[model samples]
Target: MEIWPAIDLRHGKPVRLRQGDYNQKTVFGDDPVEFAKRWQAAGAKRLHLVDLDAAKGDDPTANREAVARIVAETGLPCQMGGGVRDEAAIESLLGLGLNRLVVGSAALKQPDWFASMCDAYPKQLAAGIDARDGMVATDGWLETSSTPAIELAQDLRGRTENIAAIIYTDIARDGMMSGPNFEGLAQMAAATDIPLVASGGVTTYDDVRKLVQMQMPAAIVGRSIYDGVMQLEEVIEIAGDK
Candidate 1:
């Protein structure tokens, strides 16, 4: 499985939030571009970037400059999410050479707009199925929807052919240092034919190995790396080993 070290930006800095809470945050560094470089040097193949501020209804432009710098400076293929709602926002970010752009709430709330975007940018789109207790979470994970996460993925399969990946994030597990929701992951993987990217609660080498065994296309790790629980290189090696 491809291992993506995450760089979640909040207030123009790299920080990890507990259970997707902005108030309970741990700032890793002030310069996110430098952090990108550090991940690159440590053998990151691709980066998962997110704008926490933007995700929370803040100005979408807040982290654009930082994101552009990270992509340009490290020259790493990045998949970014958060606050990308319209065609204009999607166009602007794709112009930054982002490998993939993820749409979370928009997929469930504005299916038509999301479908149009998928049609416009084939193979460049992904749907983020961030959930809390199996219900879809929206608006930076602050609100939970009655829709089952698996049902949402199944619905999206019929909505657009443009989505190249399905990023399933277990909000409760996120930044909790517990472990990924393997059962939930397995269910989603079974529900969707799109390539899957697992996120949240990944804590150790075993987590990487388990994801590989589960046949995930890619996995995103954030808090563990920042907290010194595991190094990026070590996980890369674990994932890459034959």
Candidate 2:
């Protein structure tokens, strides 16, 4: 399994939000590019970059530039999401050389557009299914849709010629150091054939080990690494080769 260290950008700074709440945020750094380099220096093979400001709005140009610079400088394969709602933005981000582009609300609000993007981008697109209380959450985890996350994943399983991955994030456990939602992940994995990437509440090396034992493709760890709960080097050693 690949360990994806997260770098969420808000106003060009690295920060993390609790349960996807913008009000309950913690700034991790002033320079996201430097932070990405640190993660690379610590043995990060893949990086997870998010634009918090973009998730809530339509424009993410600043964070997009920051992400482009990080990818250019560190040479780490990065997957980015948030504020990706249109074809132009998607095309722009992909033009930046991102390994994968994660789409959330667009998948819910505009299935046709989502399918078109998947078809257009092939293995360069991933569906970000962020859930709360068994229901799929959209609009940065602020709105809970009627569709269940597992069902959504099942519906989108083979919609794309090469769907890069299905990134499942448990909003309740995110940024809380509580541990990942393994049961939910197992169910989602069982529901879809696409590669699954677990996100949220990954607080320790054992958490990563659990995901690897389950044969997950990858896991995203944010707060744990930023807060010193888990060392990046140790987590990478545990994950081994992708």
Candidate 3:
């Protein structure tokens, strides 16, 4: 399994929000590119980035610049999400050399556009499925839709050609330092054939071990590494990374 170190950007700084709540954010550092370099030095094969400000429909220019710096400095493949709602945004990020673009809120709010983008950017797009109690949450987790997360995964499976993976996140456990939603992940894995990248609540070596045991393709870790609850190198070793 691959362990992805998360670098969430808010106002060009590294920060993390509890349960996707913007008001409950904790700033980790002032320089996101340096943070990305630290993770890269620690054996990170890939990085997971989120633009909190953009996700909330605010200006994303700062975070976008931060992302460009991280990519240019680290020379490591990075996948980012947040306000990636249009073709121009996708073009801009891809032009910055992002390995993958994660589409969450826009995917749920506009299926046709999502489909078109998926078809347009094969193997370069990932569906960010953030869920609360198994239902899909959109608009930066500020709104919960009636769609079941598993069902959405299944639906995306039909367009597997365009999608690189399904980034399944349980909103309830996100940034809480809790363990991942194993059952929820299992259901999603069973529901779709696309590669599954487990997200949210992955905070310890044990959490990573369980994910490896489940044979997950990849997993995202954030708060634990930032808060000193877990070490990136240790978790990378636990995930069997060389």
Candidate 4:
């Protein structure tokens, strides 16, 4: 499994929100590029970046330039999500050296867009399936839908083959540091052929090990990494050993 340490950007800094709440944000670091550098130095293979401000409808281009700065500085794979709605936005970000773009709301709005995106940029896009109580959450996790995660994954097959991965976030556990919802992750992984990646509620190095040893393709650590419950070096070593 690939372990991706997350760097969620908010207000131009690395921050994490409780269960995707914008009002309850905790700043993880002052300089996100420096944070990315720290992880790269610790032997991180990839960085999962997100723009919470853009996810909240603030600005589509928020921190994209910062993304470019981090990519240039660390020279590591950076997969970003939030505020990417159209072909132009994807083009702009890819031009900025973003390794991958993660799409959530846009996928829900235009299911056909996935095929077009994958066709245009194969293996350069990722799908984020954020859910609350089994219902797919959208619009920055503020809205829930009748669509279940597996059903959506089933629907997304082939249309999203251009996707490099699937980031499945359990909104209830996100930023709470309880531990990832492993049961749900396993279930979803079993349900779809999509290469699954876990996200949210990662609270310890133990959590990272469990996910890695389980061989789920990837695990996205957010709040725990920011709050010091998890360390980048330890996770990289553990994942490597597994």
Q: Write the per-residue lDDT of candidate 2 for residues 1-242, one digit (tens) a residue.
A: 88899999998889999999999999976889988999999989889999988898846786877888999999989999998899998888889989898999998777777888888888888999999987999998889999999888777764555678888999999999999999999999988888999999999878988998999988998999989988899998898853
For every model shown, what is its TM-score relative to the native structure? 0.97, 0.97, 0.97, 0.95
If both were scored by lDDT, which would come out higher, candidate 2 or candidate 3?
3
How are the candidates ranked when ordered by TM-score, highest leading? 3, 1, 2, 4
lDDT (C-alpha, whole model) for all candidates = 0.90, 0.89, 0.90, 0.83
Report the Cα lDDT for candidate 1.
0.90
Model 1 segments more than 4 A misplaced: none
Question: Where in model 3 is the C-alpha error above 4 Å?
Answer: none
Candidate 4: give the clashing pairs.
123-162
Clashing pairs in 2: none
Q: Write the per-residue lDDT of candidate 4 for residues 1-242, one digit (tens) a residue.
A: 67788888987888878888888988866789988987787778788899887888997667877788999998887899998888988998889888898999887778898768877899888888998988899999889999998888878784666667778999989888889888999899888877888998878878888887678787887666666777777877777723
TM-score of 1: 0.97
For each of the candidates, give the backbone clash count. Answer: 0, 0, 0, 1
Task: Note the residue pairs that clash in candidate 1.
Answer: none
lDDT of 3 by residue, 152-175 (tens): 877776644677888999999999
